[model samples]
Target: MVDDRDLLKVVSGIIGEERTSDDCCMIKVGDDNIILSTDMLHESTDFPRGMTDWQIGWMSAAVTLSDVASCGAVPLALLLAAGLDEPERISGITAGAKDCCERFGAELAGGDIDFHSELTIVTTGIGRVEDEYYKTRRGAKPGDIVCVTGTPGCAGAALEGSERYWKNLVEPLPAVREGRLLAVAGVSSMMDVSDGIALSLYDLSGSSCVGFEISMDNLPLSPGVSPEMALYSGGDFGLLFTCGRDILPVTGVDCTVIGVVTDSGEVLCDGVLVERRGYSHRWMEEI
Candidate 1:
């Protein structure tokens, strides 16, 4: 069976061009460059119980903008496509989208609308970057410290029926500021943990062709979150990065050193091989 990764490979092969697994695709325009990314949230798969329409709006924008920030791009605007029937719901979604843009300093330029059987929101983020400063998921080397921008696993906890963690799940704050700081700090490689940390580490390993030795004890966990949740939970939206030098102090962001890059292609958590157990599309179990 072809999984998501396999499907991407097949599509890339069909396109006949070298493509990246990076969250966003970048293009050079004149002296500078522009980055583009899109993300969609469906009510059936994404929306948790007891979430407000405002949070739904906010998260749709945040998820797409997270991709923009991961590439060290300054958000310019957002294009939204909302599918719904209720006018009130649409209003809340657009309002939340507007608020998200305001918070992140972007513009909700325009979007489309359609009525569908289920609610769906697709947002496209537009961002700009200096030609030399864009970030990617490659370039990690041996001796680099692997770090995460903020605590993780809250969303996982929420999925496991934690009411407190529900706030984290519905109203996620994208690490845009942290991503910008890491870009300026000259991070070797970085990505957001929208997927589980285990899958994320495997991705980084494959991209940079380097192994990682992560200390499970070093993972910065949210309160009431277990090791399994911290490792396999997705929707964290924290920035995970590697740098050859020590991390510089960033205001308002909690940076934690969790592991080190190695030449071997093994990803370990406290001397144990990290398993591929996470919020898979087929099964989002908290084991």
Candidate 2:
């Protein structure tokens, strides 16, 4: 195992921040502060050998940006850490990263370049929100309503019936606006879905120590996506949350209530606990 401590030590040193913020970090500078997150994409690890360079750049931004969204923070700037076999490929990578940043009202702050045989992208994202709106993976309470932003299984729908990806899912609505919508509406403890519903929900459950119950029938589905796949697939890039039960106001993409929080340490849907553990990078194919 690479271990979280060593990884954090190296990342904190390289990024110039000696502190660890757990899932999300905050620094106070008088009245204003900032939140930071970094994600890495390696050609040998993330991309298949025959993947297209154009999609590589776009996918890089999408994956990294998802982390920022998961923190329930609005992105402000993005920095690229790139290594490439072909220098010309940097342009495409930048363009893609820039496109994603621009879509979410974020800036392409700066980047580093290195020469290598395989392409890799490392993104450092900066985001901010008022002190009152720093949503994280915690704070969920018992009886809170569990909702998911937008339709699920977007990438799954794109790869329907095919185990391996052939094309990227259609670019969905950026979660920035959705976060803004939820923040202003006074919702907290939100995260964007990346590791599939069951896994991500399990994370929220563990973080809050409150079990969850989701109604399989109410789980939102994208066109042509299966319920199981939609529920357990990643790249949905949507928000999944457990909010107070006052019918609180929310904005941006539509959300569907899948379940509620419970006292037990288990998740149930339609009278059954989720049998599969859901998707993880280490078990995508197996899931």
Please report the candidate that would top lDDT against the real structure: 1
Q: Who wins the TM-score comparison? A: 1
lDDT of 2 at 27: 70
Model 1 residue-pair collision total:
0
Error of 2 at 148 (Å): 0.4
Model 2, position 118, has a per-residue lDDT of: 74
For each candidate in the order shown, give its overall lDDT on alpha carbons. 0.85, 0.71
Clashes of each: 0, 0
Candidate 1: 10-residue stretch with minimal lDDT: 278-287
**What tens digits encode model 2's per-residue C-alpha lDDT throughout 1-287?**
33343465577777754344234576776786577777777887566555566667767776666666666678888899899889998987788778888888788889999998877788888887677777777778887888988777766665454433345353434577776677656664777776678877777776677888888889887556678877887756778877787755564447888888888878888878876455443422321
What is the per-residue lDDT of model 1 for residues 18-112, given as tens digits with 9 covering 90 to 100?
45577788887887789999887889888886778889999999998888998888899999999985666988898998999889989999999
- For all predictions, the C-alpha RMSD in Å is 3.0, 4.6
Give the Cα-based TM-score of candidate 1 against the true structure: 0.93
